[model samples]
Target: MDQGFFLLFATVSVITALMLVVARNPVHSALALMACFLQISAIFVLLEAPLLAVIQIFVYVGAIMVLFLFVIMMIDMREAVLQRFLPGGNLPALVLLVVLGVEMIVLVFWSDSFSVATPATAGGGDTIRTLGTTLFADYLLPFEAASVILLVALVGAIVLARKEPG
Candidate 1:
């Protein structure tokens, strides 16, 4: 039962991710990205991380996706959508994708690191409290860095969307 749900969520996530990359319209791509994020949240639920699942849906699907759609709406994408790709432009990407897929398969099948292991028991404390403490204490730098990166991206989008006065 759990395995079936996991497979369903994982497959939808992969399909939506592919749609996000291949969709020509920026709005469609953003919608696909939102679908991918929802599928990922479902996977987090299957993994018994309800808090993470909620955060995924709230942060990625709710807040970040809204921001993405706002940016997409602000930009004029007609030229971008109508642009032609250079001949065989995707060949290099296809080759890289194939190589990475083969490498991942080899790693999954042959690497001892992927072997099943005993699951670790949760620490004897409030899970959310522990997570908050760890995030602010141990991983504070990375957390703040990610926030700064997001801030920069938001500002960049605003600047790009601004109309220039003649």
Candidate 2:
């Protein structure tokens, strides 16, 4: 990977991520998230993982962004956006974010090879096949569990939508 291109994508990714967090409108946030995902996909491409790059674009940018947009459109967030934030309403969330930030900082600074990229191996030619084999052979249970969990969430969403708001 060219250092200049890597730096460009990494900078754009971080900027877009920050934009996603700072954007007031949910739709704008989703768009910023999509930009961040695209930049990360470019980074994946630089790493010679075309399959992951494509999946990032198709799954995260395309499908997940659409889902976010749909949820944003369906919900009434006008009042939520207009309301003033109370001091302690978000304390738990702020504390959780601080904890996550500390953990990420520790992981990045503590690891000796944090800045080094793994050497490319020979058998990465057939990425899709390799991904499928690894998914089914090594990670089958986790994969199935994720699918089941998503299914349950979808069903729950449908049921909630159909229920009366008594």
Candidate 3:
């Protein structure tokens, strides 16, 4: 992976994640979340996992984000309460951020692991074909479980969106 592009995607991902947390409007927050997901998918591509990148875009950004937007739209936004920012509320997050920064610096400057280049595709058939075979053959149960969970979540969202009986 190219260091320059990785750094750019990482920076954008972090900024958009913070924006998602801080946005006053729920819709804006969802939009920021989508931006963050896109940046993350780009980072996945940089890591030479195009399958993961496509899944990230389609699953999280396409389907899940649309569900999030629908939920946000169904809610009464006018009745939403604004939270007051306490001065000390973010201390734990700040500490974790500092630790993450130190870890990144150490990884970039001292680690030899990143010096090695990995092949873009694993074990030789077409990338998508290999992925499909592996997923359905080796990981079928887990994949089906994930799909069921997503289906349940979708049904729950629809339930929540339905009008209440008077």
lDDT of each: 0.82, 0.78, 0.84
Please identify model 1 stretches exceeding 4 Å from their true place: 82-89, 111-121, 136-145
- Candidate that beats the other on TM-score, 1 or 3, i.e. the better one: 1
Residue 76 C-alpha lDDT in model 1: 73
lDDT of 2 by residue, 1-166 (tens): 4656777997788789878876878788988999999999999888877778999899988987887677666656765578766777667876876797678768867988756767464474676777788889999999999899877866765654453579
TM-score for each candidate, following the candidate numbering = 0.78, 0.69, 0.68
- Estimate candidate 2's RMSD in Å: 3.7
Residues 27-94 of candidate 3: C-alpha lDDT, one tens digit per residue: 89999999999999998988889779999999899989988998988966555454456778788887
Candidate 2 collision pairs: none
Q: How accurate is candidate 1 locally (lDDT)?
A: 0.82
lDDT of 1 by residue, 101-162 (tens): 67866776797744543333367758888878888999999999999999999999899788
Greater-lDDT candidate between 1 and 3: 3
TM-score of candidate 3 versus the correct structure, residues matched by position: 0.68
Candidate 2 lands at a TM-score of: 0.69
Best lDDT among the predictions, by candidate number: 3
> Order of candidates by lDDT, top first?
3, 1, 2
